[model samples]
Target: MNVTESEIIKIHNFIDLLNSKKDSIVVVEGKRDASALKKLGYYGKLCEFHSFKGLINFADSIASYKNLIVLFDGDRKGKYLTSKIISRLEHRIRIDLSFKRKLVTITKGKIRHIEDLSTYTRLDRFTVL
Candidate 1:
């Protein structure tokens, strides 16, 4: 991956934001998305969208949380899910979509899926040492 230093800084800033909002639950489409965030050093709570029986059930499950940081993929399905979730829970709790938006901005349109977030980071097959 030809990741520039500026990109790494952006990703670090994103992760820092996640850390700042650590009290909120982070929602993703699947386990891989959650895994990527974990790999990026976010040790906070994570809920996978697919793990729920349905949208209502998902909402019910997470309704108790005071805040939620949604990070669904930026595809058609993801957008649909995001809107549906917002519609259902907008009155219930604070849903923050800023994480997803910042993720998109940091990747510069190169990455659309949360699972592929790591692709924007530097990959070194062998360290000099």
Candidate 2:
């Protein structure tokens, strides 16, 4: 699996962007999604959807944050959840699906959740190698 230098830089930039937003809440679908991000070295606050009482309450809780990154999976259910969140959050949220979409497309069906992002992207592989 040969990754281009540009791709490496892009991944690094993505990591940097994420790192820069240390205080921004990362809205994920479940504990697995949050755990996957942790495995990739993201230590920011995570707003888990499953733990929330409801969508309205969840959106209200994070309304205080000026910026947010929503990293939902690209699957059917994931897409629906993402839409709902975006609709509820209005315009204060940033839906970052680039990494997830690329991961799924590259893996060719190996992954379907935020939890499996690292395994497919191998973004860590490039850095570690």
Tens-digit per-residue lDDT, 1-129, candidate 1? 456667777887788879887458989999888887887777778899999979888888887788989898889999999999999889988999988888777778777889887664334122221
The top-ranked prediction according to lDDT is 1
Lowest lDDT 10-residue stretch of candidate 1:
120-129
Model 1 misplaced regions, further than 4 Å: 121-129
Tens digits of per-residue lDDT for model 2, 1-129: 455555545544555567677557777888888877776666667779888878878877887776677778768988898788768676765555555555545455455677875552466564643
How far does residue 74 in candidate 1 sit from its true spot (Å)? Answer: 0.8
Q: What's model 1's lDDT at 114?
A: 90
Q: What is the C-alpha lDDT of each candidate?
A: 0.81, 0.68
Model 2 stretches astray by more than 4 angstroms: 1-13, 91-111, 118-128
Backbone clashes in model 1:
0
TM-score of each: 0.89, 0.70
Residue 110 error, candidate 1, Å: 0.9
